[model samples]
Target: MELVINKILNEEDFELYLKTVESFDIINPFYKLLASNIEELLNDKLRYFTLKNDDGEVLVLMPFILRKVPYLEDGQVYYDVISPYGYSGPLFNQDMSRGHLITFWKLVDEWYKANNIISEFVRFSLNHNFQFYSGVLIPTLSNVRGAILDEETQWSNLKQKVRTNYRKGASNELRADIVDGVKPEDVERFYRIYISTMKRVNADTDYFYSLDYFKNIARLSKGKILITFIYKDDTPISTELILISGNTLYSYLGGTLMDFFNLRPNDFLKVEVMKWARKRNFKYYNLGGGRVDFDSLYSYKKSFFPNDEDVIFYTGRKIIDKEVYDKLDKIMNAEVYLEKEEVMEEENDSKISFFPAYRRNAFNR
Candidate 1:
């Protein structure tokens, strides 16, 4: 059987791509409808590739953004294919045999080569959509657990300490409201608190999102994005942005005031979010992974799903053009590259762990 691989380029095919995503239950909200808004705000190009049967029924879809590698001059074209900011890899609706997977990958490799895509990075969804999809892609599974919402015993599953924090916040007069979409004022408040939280943690500048970014996300998500803001006497203390895809809610981005940390607003915020998801009949509330597995942050999220096992987040990277990749690598690490701007720093021959190291600091503002 011949599998037709189609690349969706302009608006004409983009409309069909969106319709196809809406028709299938194979992807999360990030890949389904939010990718467009994200691309618009980030000023990146969307590259959607799909595989279909001979009958024209779509079988697999891999949506990625072609991010240009910065600091490179003209004629030295290279790109890194990355999933848009969240959990999305390749989505497959039908069961595919090993042969099918291999053939699809071969065709994808050809497409990547023709497009000058030097490397690919993917973050797989935790909803079990693309699990065990082994072919040429290998993913590193993380030790993280997504908190499941159990109608019967979701509350009972929480750790005693977690419940105590939840109560503490309530007793301290902390409250939260789940808004349909993040309002302009709330976006401002969220960004202020979010920036403060980032500064508190000494986070890299790359993690700091602009106010316009949040606004665009809310606009793009349509009604799929929800914001729960924790307030202490009319003053916003913490806020979380949740993304709904199918029957699951992802606790995507959040921020809490460092001064009010003792009030346990963040803890109460999670409890309230879970309760809302439960009442709305959501199956899971994916409290995302921490900086490291089983760390303090992960432990806090894990306490909510005491009866359920931890969910592993998977990631994969593929080098599409090894020769071009090596050339870029050499250029990035070369003395000439470093001396181009008359920089003063000791050069280390040791390789950095960043993927396609040439574009490592591309996001550093």
Candidate 2:
């Protein structure tokens, strides 16, 4: 079977591409709908890469942004290879064989070289899990799984701590309601709490999304996106933005007032979201992982699924131009690279792990 590879360039092609495959939570049609919004915000180019059969049947599609690299003379670019936020990777319609994957990468490499793409970074999906990646890049990173619930599962499956917290939240009269369609005011309120949460965590400035960004989310996700709010005495305490795509319910973004910690509002919010998902017959509710390893945040998520291992949150990076990448890396980590060959070696024995270290600080993370 011969496969033809092409880059999607127009709105007509993108809309057609959306119709070719089943929807995904992280890379769904809704996610693609918001691509233009993100491009307008970040001044990047949204491009779709596709591998299709001779009969024009699409097998794999990857939507990514071409972000211009700063400090470059010739306008070099790199593929984000996923949406600006959330999890995304290659979405497949059929089972991809090792040979098919190898061919796909060959096409991708050719396109990368043609576009002068210096490198690429990808965040793979959780629902449509793939155990391996081939060619120039492979996934060495993973996302931890907080919990996985079955349709027939009982509340008893949850950790005692989680159950206790749920009860505590109930005792405090914390109530959660899922919005049918999010409003501008609702997004603003959520953003207020979201901003506070970022500040509380000392997150990088890039985490601070603008109001227009949330507005665009509400507009693009349509009815598939719901914001669940936990309220006490009609005052919002915790809120989570959920995206229903395919058979999985993703707990996308959320925030809670730290002041309501004692009331266990966060725990109650998750319980309510899960109950909603269960009622809808959704197969999985991805609670998502923490920023790092099993820290306090992970501990909190772990309370829900005490016995489960973390889900692999896979990530990959590929460098297209080795010389350009090294030069950029050295420029970014000049303090380490600028020192004498002998003196630098002894002074800094450790090597930097940041991919294309020159663009390390470019991301909000």
Candidate 3:
């Protein structure tokens, strides 16, 4: 079957494909629903592509943002379909086959070089089947890839680990205080814990989002974000933020004050969260993927979240207009976030607002 690729450039087109892609079970961003006013968020410098056969059967889908190096572009363009958080890649329709893919890639290659974006397409270590995918794409699989999986009948869960750890830690009374009400003030404490954890791991703060970003998401996402703080003795030793949308309650973020490590606060925290979900009758908990098979982080995530959701990722690229792309590559490689930025980053020692209105008012000199 003859195959052709087209970019989504209209409101009608976006909606049509969105409904079509839902059957694939891929997670579409909530922002996508508000495509009209928030095109920047949905398409946002992104180039969404659609592939179909001669019979007009939707074969495969790929959407990427035009990652424009504005300073270097000198007014040129190069783009790759990417995910901001997760589950943003390809959408293959029913008619997908090897032959159609080959044709589509040739077109992509010709298009990329023709556009003068690059010599070839590069996808950042993204897709599982890199061998089959061609054109301008490099799958970036190395950047902390993981899956949400439930352990087999044999593997130990998080609760079991906690029990063992509690014995090891020789804890006092293992109690959990559940707070039904959630507040914005909690996010600040959560950020502190997350920031502290990141510092412990020597991670970059770029991944650490600002409070405004969190506040914006919480406000805009409607009832999608469900946050639960687990406490013991009226003190929050550990807390977990679970993003609830549809049937999945993704164990999104968690942090703890190191002082309560003795009571196995984390283990207890996980169990309580799991119990809440089971009580409320939620389906899945996205424990998230580990860096590699059997990594320590993966092992830790496994204790509470055992459902292994094998998510599919899609990517492709092409040197659309070769003359335009060669310069683009040089420009892309040349750009880098300098190391000095880190050296200059010092923790704020002065009193500042942590969150709530009262806190901000109290801190303001």
Candidate order, TM-score descending: 2, 1, 3
Candidate 3 Cα misplacement greater than 4 A, ranges: 1-63, 70-81, 90-160, 166-183, 303-365
Residue pairs clashing in model 2 are: 142-313, 143-312, 143-313, 145-310, 145-311
Q: Where is model 2 more than 4 Å wrong at Cα? A: 1-30, 33-42, 72-83, 95-99, 127-132, 135-153, 335-352, 361-365
Candidate 2 per-residue lDDT, tens place, 307-354, comes to: 666566666667778887777666655544334433534553222255
Each model's C-alpha lDDT? 0.70, 0.65, 0.49
Error of 3 at 47 (Å): 6.2
Candidate 1, residues 1-365, lDDT tens digits: the string is: 34444445555666677787766754577875444454343463676667777887767777777777654657676677777667777676655654555566678777778877888877777755444443234434444444555645666777898789989999999988988756788778778888888989998876877777788667657678888999999888999888888787878788888889899998799888877877787777778766766667777777777667667766666787787777776666564444632332343322214565555444420
Worst 10 residues of 3 by lDDT: 351-360
TM-score of model 3 (CA atoms): 0.57
Off by over 4 Å in 1: 1-16, 33-44, 69-76, 94-100, 127-152, 181-189, 335-352, 358-365
- Top lDDT: which candidate number? 1
Name the better of 1 and 3 by lDDT.
1
